[model samples]
Target: MNAATQYAISWKGLKNGTYHFDFKVDKALFQEFESTEIEDGDLNVSVTAERTEKELSLHVAIRGTVTVACDRCLEPYQQPVAFDGDLLIRFSDEEQEYDGEVLWLAPGETEASLAQYIYESIVLALPYQRVHPDGGCDPDMLSRFRIVSEEEFEAIEQEAEARHAQPLDNESLSRLTALRQRLEEEDGESEEKN
Candidate 1:
């Protein structure tokens, strides 16, 4: 069976009520979609499907950890992921997408696969900047970037801050103030004309 087939839900003969399905999502499932951001993960996905007369609503809850490359160290590390989402499937004569949060099913459709939705929820739950906590990163990689003493580092930071905080000369400040006044006057004149 294909990857999507495993996640398909058949509503052909079922009555309108609530249903539950659980799946263990791993690297294989992600790779099926050619996902490159995440290489592997161990997550439990719980899907709750509630069918009513007008629509079918699905609640997706994903919780577990996934391995991602560190932005600074470039080493793979496990990152915890927790996400919750809702999908609304509406019946229509022809398949049509109302928006990102809603999907349309044809009148004769029998199955709906949730593999793509599950993948997107997991990926979106990850942090944009993937990095280990302080002192958790590889020491060897950090040493290559900065090996200075604590006092030396503090001194360098203070020096940089002082440079940024220095005030401009009086001549330059006066020139800037005059330029600002001129711009404001020009703006007022243009507004009056309009």
Candidate 2:
């Protein structure tokens, strides 16, 4: 089968039974998808798709190591990642929003590939703000960051204390308290809205 065909599976092929499939992702797969974030690595995926009369369930277990540039130093390093997730596929005549763990695929569709999902899972597993653990970083970079962070922290604390020390009347203090309450309310509202 062609690459596109290999990527998607037909729903008829997965009726009322459990099936296993595996794919090995290497440099070629990345190249095909034009993914520059991962230039070198190997990924293994074990997928179990089971159909129970009406609903289709897919469970995917992923394991792999990808080479990525260290955030502290521009040097390349390998990061290992593992993840498991389930997708539910419900046969539907019309496109519908599904809130469950499963993804819905239209009936008669052939071959489903989890390459993109696996890649995204691995990427999400990485730290949002990656910094080498304390002494584990490059000496020069760590030293510079330490000095900058300390200076910034001190400056911020001093500014906060200075603001808090300013004298105020009872009326002014009441207004300040009200303003603080309003700000806290706004913060909570924003979080809920998000």
Which candidate wins on lDDT? 1
lDDT of each: 0.78, 0.62
Q: What is the lDDT of residue 108 in candidate 1?
A: 88
lDDT of 1 by residue, 153-181 (tens): 45644554566767655665575556556
Model 2 reaches what TM-score against the true structure? 0.59
lDDT of 2 by residue, 1-194 (tens): 43344445456645588888787656665566676666677778787888788876888787887776666554566667687888777777777755545555666554444555655666666654444445455668545643233344455446555777675556755755565565566456546644
Q: Rate residue 122 of model 2 by lDDT.
A: 61
Total clashing pairs for each candidate = 0, 12
Query: What are the models' TM-scores?
Result: 0.72, 0.59
